[model samples]
Target: MDWDKLRIFHAVADAGSLTHAGDVLHLSQSAVSRQIRALEESLETTLFHRHARGLILTEQGELLFDATQAMSKRLDAASARIRDTEEEVFGNLRVTTTIGFGSIWLAPRLRKLYANYPDLSIDLMLEERVLDLPMREADIAIRMKEPSQADLVRKRLMDIRMQLFASPAYIEANGMPRRMKDMTQHRLICQAQGATQVSAGAMLVRELMTYAVERTLTVNNYFGVLQSVVSDLGIGVLPDYLQQDFPQLVRVLPEVESNEVPVFLAFPEELRGSRRVQAFRDFVVEEVVAYRRARQIAAQ
Candidate 1:
């Protein structure tokens, strides 16, 4: 069976029209029709029933479509693996990560990855939105939360602890909050990005709001929130490691709930066995683990 013809058939069946399928496949309408015809002839079965409105898949076509979709994914994965063997782990790696983590953490570490593998190309995209891996939007993703889907392969990278912090100047001017209840009297900055876990910020805000405490300001990104807190805009919660960089910043409440934010390294399950993907994944995991251990020892 011609894989190309099967691919064309799958596209047409999915699109429900030859014109739309052609548009998707970047082929002419007639070309799409020819490929579908060839596929049907090869299979010796009528795949689609033609109607006045458009094309509809037959019973046999429906079954074939299910099988073809799975086959296409497997074939694509196989092709990527084969290419990896020939190309020496040299391809554009599209990585998705959050703004703060990408800047302060991954960006710096990526230098080492480049140093070890000069041929490897990287396109690092930092955003709050999660990119779809199955759609080929991203080759790898570093997210705060683990993906629950069985089709994705996820590994827990680290446990990020959140702490409520403020600048010394702000605490001096506004008076330090000795208790969570005292937080109500002062202004607090909130993140526009919703927290998936009960981090310090989320916990503080939830408690404050439950008691009808007023929040001063809200920002979209963590970097922006951190900046606001640094400039003494208002007290806000931030990651523990982030405070090490700035001497002026001090933890506001040391007794806040400790939430372990599990960072994950995830990729499509289909690409798990690919040599290049496997190699890069292993390298990143090792680097992150070593970095975490070094940080622990330094803190001690």
Candidate 2:
């Protein structure tokens, strides 16, 4: 149970190659191999199975690796907490959200946040999968639905609805859909039916597909769908929030819309006092409020 040897073993097990682990640890491959051998001798067990391709963890090695992984995450959480001081918000903050919202909405508005806290570093993870917050997969998450995990500090940010949109050029060429049935005359762009998306968005796409549009383009993520629409490809089903950023996009078939999808912001309860988390939370709340106000003003 030498801590140094355990560290080397973790690095090798994680990388699956002594040379790669050596590169990361700044040690020679022979040196790393010596440490692993010492650790195995101390424990009287084999840690890895060697092969031409690389190393694979033995059953005992898997158990030890699991323990080391937990230890590493705990150390990271502690380091983050220590780095976060009350007087300054200077540290890395991992924020996870769907690709569409992160790319189209949040990324554009992040400059304001950076202006306020110039020292803050943000790692924005954009994907469809929900990362585990409690285990430190990500520090904070902005999800379409309320997080169901235990020991989470959650806040409802806003609700968004899926609606149809098309560029003015596309609408002019293809003609606007005066009614739902008019969709048959134009091409449709949307997230593929089996793609991972919020239930509300999928429902809207399904309802639109029922019209039997002749030409269709289906992308896996909303960013792609928005790009296609912006390119004058076809009418697309997209979140209503996009209107503020994409003024050129005309809302098509104003009467058609989807049920609201509630957006939530959440973090581990243990990070309740983290200044970095607080700053990000406050920044996001302000952005959402400003966006809402902008939409209201546009309506007037």
The TM-scores, one per candidate, come to 0.67, 0.97
Off by over 4 Å in 1: 1-79, 193-201, 244-248
lDDT of 2 at 49: 100
lDDT of 1 by residue, 1-300 (tens): 787888889999889999999999999999999988888888899999999889999999999998887777666656676677644677667789888777766777777788777878888998978887875567788888887667898999887876778988888899988887787887777664374423555665666556555766777666777888989877876666575456578788788744677889999977876666776787888877887777777679
lDDT agreement of model 1 with the native: 0.78
> Which prediction has the highest lDDT against the true structure?
2
Going through the candidates in the order shown, the clash numbers are 0, 0
- Residue pairs whose backbone atoms clash in candidate 2: none
lDDT of 2: 0.94
Residue pair clashes in candidate 1: none
Question: Per-residue lDDT for 1-300 in model 2, tens only?
Answer: 799998999999999999999999999999999999999999999999999999999999999999998888888888998888879999799999999999999999999999999999999999999899988999999999999997999999999999999999998897888999899888889998899999998998888888887789999999999999999999999999999999989999898999999999999988898999999999999999999999999999
Task: Give the whole-model CA lDDT for all candidates, comma-separated.
Answer: 0.78, 0.94
* Model 2, TM vs. native: 0.97
TM-score top scorer? 2
